[model samples]
Target: MAGPYWFARNIRAGYVGRDRYGKGVMPIAWQGRAVIAGFVAAMIGGGATMFLLFFYAHQMALGVVIYVILVIGGAGTFIWAVATRSDPDKSLAVYLAERQRARSTGR
Candidate 1:
């Protein structure tokens, strides 16, 4: 899951998370609302794609269309979320600070 991978990488690099993640798990912050629908669409599209690859290979065109739509929708939602956020640059700043701190501590 590239979404989760990039998210975890950003978190580890201190690019996000103003609040701490409970239970040692942190989900992508799509403004806290679209996460559910996003999850469902991603899971269903991916699962259907895999299932089609095995049983009904001929139906792969349909699966590809559905999967593409899901990806586009997810990307659109992420863009929208960024547009609505007031302090998107804060995370970038935090990331830079973390990098500087790490460099200083290393030397």
Candidate 2:
């Protein structure tokens, strides 16, 4: 099926490829990179806000709640994006084997 796919199983040349340990995927494309960047930014922003709220504003409870929400939400979204955007049918081992076969066949 054709799609607005942001990830692929072509590990050697995909934008997002399966991790070597068979646990996750890593960004190899600009789109995937942008997702990572956004996550990092969100985390940093949340941390700064939490720090300010806890120390300066004297709102420790609020700060903790907000920080927890941000962490859960951000992590959930990131995981969802990676899972939904990646090629689901193939694993790292499969891709590696395919690459090996292609190389051997000189194709």
Candidate 3:
């Protein structure tokens, strides 16, 4: 899935893995869980949505309901993962900031 594909797309631009790289490495379980939840939820929910919309074009409301369910369910999973994560989201923000600073400073 593109979610997993992009989630694993290493921001480490040096043609190699860096321990400090955020996008490629899953140093934390919570983060991995979040990614998994999003991908799996999207796959299942999106497939269901498409199936309904394709087969039951007459039932537009049903498709909308399915999409809403997917959104809520997927959000629930993500919230749970994030709530359990010991590392705060700020860590990632800080990391990206440092990376950007490094690149700008030509380190």
Better of 1 and 2 by TM-score: 2
In candidate 3 the C-alpha lDDT for residue 61 amounts to 72
What would the per-residue lDDT of candidate 2 be over residues 1-107, giving only the tens digit for each residue? 21443445444444444443343575534676677777787788788889999889999888888878877777887777787887666544565567688789998
Clashing pairs in 2: none
TM-score to native of every candidate shown = 0.41, 0.61, 0.42
User: How far in Å is the alpha carbon of 42 misplaced in model 2?
Assistant: 1.8
Tens digits of lDDT, candidate 3, 1-107: 11211122224334433453554333233456566668587768766886779687866677777777777677676555544543422344445566688789998
lDDT of 1 by residue, 1-107 (tens): 11322122122353336543222222234433454467567768776785676477767767667777777777676555444442333333354566578788994
User: What residue pairs clash in candidate 1, if any at all?
Assistant: none
- Top model number, lDDT: 2
Show the lowest summed lDDT stretch of 10 residues, model 2.
Answer: 1-10
Error of 3 at 13 (Å): 20
| Candidate 3: C-alpha lDDT | 0.54
Q: Number of clashing residue pairs in every model?
A: 0, 0, 0
Candidate 1 Cα deviation (angstroms), residue 35:
3.4
Misplaced by over 4 Å in model 1 are 1-30, 33-44, 86-107
Better of 2 and 3 by TM-score: 2
